[model samples]
Target: MTKKGGSKHLKRLAAPAFWPILKKEYRWVTKPSPGPHPLGRCIPLLILVRDMLKLAENAREAKRIIFDGEVLVDSKVRRNFKLPVGLMDVVSIPRIDVHVRIIPHTIKYLWYVGVPKEEVNLKLVRIENKSLIKGNRLQLNLHDGRNILISREESQKYKTLDGLLIEIPSQKIVQHIPLEVNKLAIVMDGRNAGRIGRIIEIQEKPGMSRRKFLVTLEEASGHRFQTILEYVMVIGDDKPIIKVSEGT
Candidate 1:
């Protein structure tokens, strides 16, 4: 019988726009199927290990390392080479004592940020959806494709686009940072991503077909930029709840 379902190979030129690979370098690349993150926003685990991180020379080596039970994503060993590792997902190689968090890169649309081993358990998830469930429980749908339940009263304090510092495995929310002016934020999408800044102003334009909000971010170097509200993720009130320094 002929094989069916998703194709394993994708033309390099036809890959998603977010893919950082050079289209002319190779004719084909692995197309990661739907996993923990949306297809357009994620890269295959093999590509991340072999191409981006340069940890392995080829796909075979990457698979070997994964199958050896040496690769952990969000604190759980992941053997699937095609698994999607997207925004804010923690990838750790315990054997090498290397840990990284995938974030929007200032140059690449998405890039990996080296994180301290102690902070590997910390994750940032944006609240994308919420709904009331039975027993007065409120279900929150995070951007990471995770569904977590919180009390209705607690849900009332959270809104879409708010960032949460959650602990891995336990999935406990350590802090809640609201989206507002003067708050520390990070660009979660677009070219300016991974840049830490503070919200200087929020502009809501009226008389538009759909309501739109734009935020002005002032970087630590006294530089400023603007981005749509959806691109910003609140990280803290006074300081980041999790360590985000490059060397940390």
Candidate 2:
């Protein structure tokens, strides 16, 4: 995939089948785990897994934890959340991998966590994305340490990519893609883990065809049922509001 863009970037969207969703909601889904992992804040994954980290151990040990089924995204067990998740990605793991911060060379963006002055825009040699963009506050594990949250800033950072100090500019943090696609947030927590259904219709009035999404949720016990539940607006957000989930 090639195009005339501002900078010579790599990759389009991530591979469609790259992620494997869990069949059922894990019991630890609502345990209030930290979010926006450190790997997500620094840069895109292509740059992380390729270079930058100082890895001197056996390569397979690192690969198994990052690539295997240990990572979860948005309450679902995601095997490959590191492939190329952007601002739209939500990540989590079952039992907090306490060995995260000590992994050596993983840059993290932390919300509820602050960052130092010197660690921004650094490429990740073993992770997926590393160039810390803006609006990316992340919590990360760095080598036998507690999970940490840190933020990155804009500055002129130089790295010897091809033996030359490649001067890179500060990154801006702007999230929200497909900006037109309104989010269907889960209002009722703990029920189906907010993975119930998609919006089917929207109405300026009670009954109208103005619905947005038609969703199919994987209910517990592996049943695929159809319903129009998730939507952008609630029953009283506006006059004669359009409601998705019942009793809204």
Candidate 3:
């Protein structure tokens, strides 16, 4: 048998520094293309299973588990080791009774968090774009690259940046959370990543150089932090719509 000819290794220097791995020791690593998650914000499924989760001893073991239809991402079995899993995405291994969701972290860009059984199918995705299709149907482009189409009338209530709580496998919309003042949000970058708070105020900068709007977040303990609009992801109105717990 012959191996594939394409490059399968990513340069350690070119990889994202925030990734939890020994950067200097390994000269090459897996580089995944744009998939459910963006390139820089996601890690390859192989490294996640082998190195992060310690589920498999090596890449070969990880690939075997995935190919055997034991690894499910977003409720669907994924065999590709290079699949990109990002924030808010759920990972499940029924055989081990283990499930986790990727969440943002201040120190590490993203990290895995344990997800209870009841919350395994729930995921929040932000509306990144909206467009009208040929048959008068409205198309919603999600932050994770998933698309959903509905009637124009049905989509009237949704706007760009709004969050939708969807049930996996079925992809049914269970809740719609709007992006506005007083809504609950989480900082995704720059100083504060996992801090959950309510939106106190939003300031739009029309003529700024590269920065746009700024959002003010007020934590439960009265602490406040300001971040660029793009650095936050709206997750709820009064509180989080799903369960979040740190994994071992």
Candidate 4:
């Protein structure tokens, strides 16, 4: 296929899995259009950026370099997330000593993996091999040499314990906050204080807990802040509802 034709193919494959878009904006890039009409011919751009960052040992440091004006794209300083960058775009980073050429791609999962047929972004955006070794009794491997494992409960569900339909998006439960959106349950010393709050974000701190859920917990009643991951839940809907404390 010609270069132009190849781009069109990549766009079709990547549009649904990565970027949340309904229709292709190929017309937009090839023609004149308005703000954010979706990447016209930059399907490979997504793969390039993702791969570049994935190789980085420290994502925070990488982000700092990207935002600190140390990176250049196509002989120009490019920081904007939305650009018509394609597989041909050249990315230069001074601090990390890396140059990236974007490529088109698809989502990857572990062995015995399958995902929902829907086009929604997979919940687990990233998973490395042997990341969940030793059955459901082990923690999740952060792939960053971190042991940010989920609780046995969360692991069991992710391992198809209750026959929960595991989707890519659902895998992202680890990264996403345990909020009402994902049916996250929070407890303190075996006490339920309502479905605390919505999980908004997760931080994979080095030398800290494997991955920490940064929650916007809604305390129907209880103490503020507690040791996380000792016990938490992001198992999705139909979990045991708990708000009333024991012996209350």
Candidate 5:
């Protein structure tokens, strides 16, 4: 008989570079089960607990902790150890009072930044796309597989790449930050990944050029550079609504 489904195992060498695991020391690593985020952009909950958070000594311990309903993703209990935890997702362990939000890193593809107790329920999600849906409502597709419905009139206020501050679980939109000049933004990918700065200028081209829309960003250090609009995520208007850096 042929294999029925995808492989349950992932070789360490084949794991994502952002995963902080020994490549050669181990033959196989836990493969993230299909979830909201894609395999390349998210980390398995088991690996996150055991390796990144250092809350568990081994896979067994991590599984135990997760099975006990001690782990909460987005303010809800998540028992699946293979659950994918991706960007802007909150992981909380009430017992240990641990809370962290995954964000883009300059070196690693992703990194976890501590979240304050008060802000644990808040999350920032980018508007990947939007379209008209049933009832003539506009549906906003967020980066993390979430969809928000709004009235057609409200749709005019939002655009792709805009950031929405939402309440987890409830998912109520608290604020919307547009991607415009003078707005604070972060590079989500490319060579300048994880760099946060203010948008200074936007150059939109008409042709099929690879760089169709380039945005110039000025960092706090007074350095300015241009990157594709696809790589830029508006974080705030002046300063970031939340702490995105370790120092901040």
Candidate 6:
């Protein structure tokens, strides 16, 4: 008889290119469990602990560490070894005092950047979409699987693609960064993925669709390029609130 569910295993060769794993060295790889992010855009917790962070010598060791509640994602203990960690998610190993935030990369699709202890509880999430809900509340859907409900009047201040700096665990909004000219933004995808710059101009199309709009960004090196509004994420106003690049 054939199985009705998806396969539990993932082949090494079928893994994403951005994953820092050897395809030929191993035949099978750990498949990320269904989570906030899709398989192609996330790193499995087992792979993260064993391979990327080198915290464990092998899969068995990694599973032991994760099962012991030593690993925390977004300030909460995540016991699942196959938990999917995606962009802007914070991973912490309190036993060793290690903390890292997943961010966009120029070469690799996503990468982890070391963050200070004070920033461990803070996270930035992009507003993917929003809608009206019961009790005159507006629900904001973030890039992650989190949903924030607010008064409809207050929701008017926020727009899609805007970034919200929130305190994890509590999930309190500390600040809102709007996407507009002169704001610091980062390209999440396309040819300019991971490029950080200032938005110089916003070219809006005649239609009402915001996705068709174009944003021109000027890098610090004086290079400028145009990308779709969908690919741009506003990170800050004058400067980034957290460490985004390495060696900063």
Q: lDDT tens string, model 3, 1-248?
A: 88866555689788887776778887887888558776688989988898888999877898999899899999999998899988888999999999989888767778888888998889988888798889979999988888888887888799878889999978789999988899998876677887888999988766863234888899889999888777778877766888643521
Off by over 4 Å in 3: 1-8, 206-211, 245-248
Q: For residues 151-222, what per-residue lDDT tens digits would candidate 2 score against the true structure?
A: 644122221110011111221221211101122322121223323233233234345443333444332345
The candidate with the higher TM-score, 2 or 6, is 6
Ranking by lDDT: 6, 5, 1, 3, 4, 2
Model 2 weakest 10-residue run by lDDT: 159-168
Instruction: List model 4 lDDT by residue over 1-248, tens digit each.
Output: 54543333333344434343234544221211122113442332223344335533343544455556676654467555334444223455545565543322222100011112231222221122224456555554421122345656655334311112122313333233222333544332123322343344444467774424333333335334433443244433433231111211
Cα-based TM-score, every candidate = 0.90, 0.21, 0.91, 0.24, 0.95, 0.95
Over the stretch 1-248, how does candidate 6's per-residue lDDT look in tens digits? 97888989899999999999989997998899998999888999998999889999999999999999999999999999999999889999999999999988999878999999999999989999998987989999999899998897897799998999999988899999988899999888788989999999999878657966988999988999999988888889778988777844
Q: Candidate 5, residues 26-136: lDDT per residue as tens digits? A: 799999999899888899999999999999999999999999999999999999999999988999999989999988899997989998998899999999889898899
What lDDT would each prediction earn against the true structure?
A: 0.84, 0.27, 0.83, 0.35, 0.91, 0.91
Model 4 poorest ten-residue lDDT run: 108-117
Considering every candidate listed, which one attains the maximal TM-score?
Answer: 6
Ranking by TM-score: 6, 5, 3, 1, 4, 2
Cα-based lDDT at residue 152, candidate 4: 62
Candidate 1, TM-score vs. the true structure?
Answer: 0.90
lDDT of 4 at 39: 47
Q: Which stretches of candidate 4 lie over 4 Å from their true place?
A: 1-15, 18-40, 43-52, 55-63, 104-248
| RMSD, every candidate, angstroms | 2.7, 21.2, 3.7, 18.0, 1.7, 1.4
Predicted candidate 3: what Cα RMSD to the true structure?
3.7
Q: How well does candidate 6 score on lDDT at residue 99? A: 97
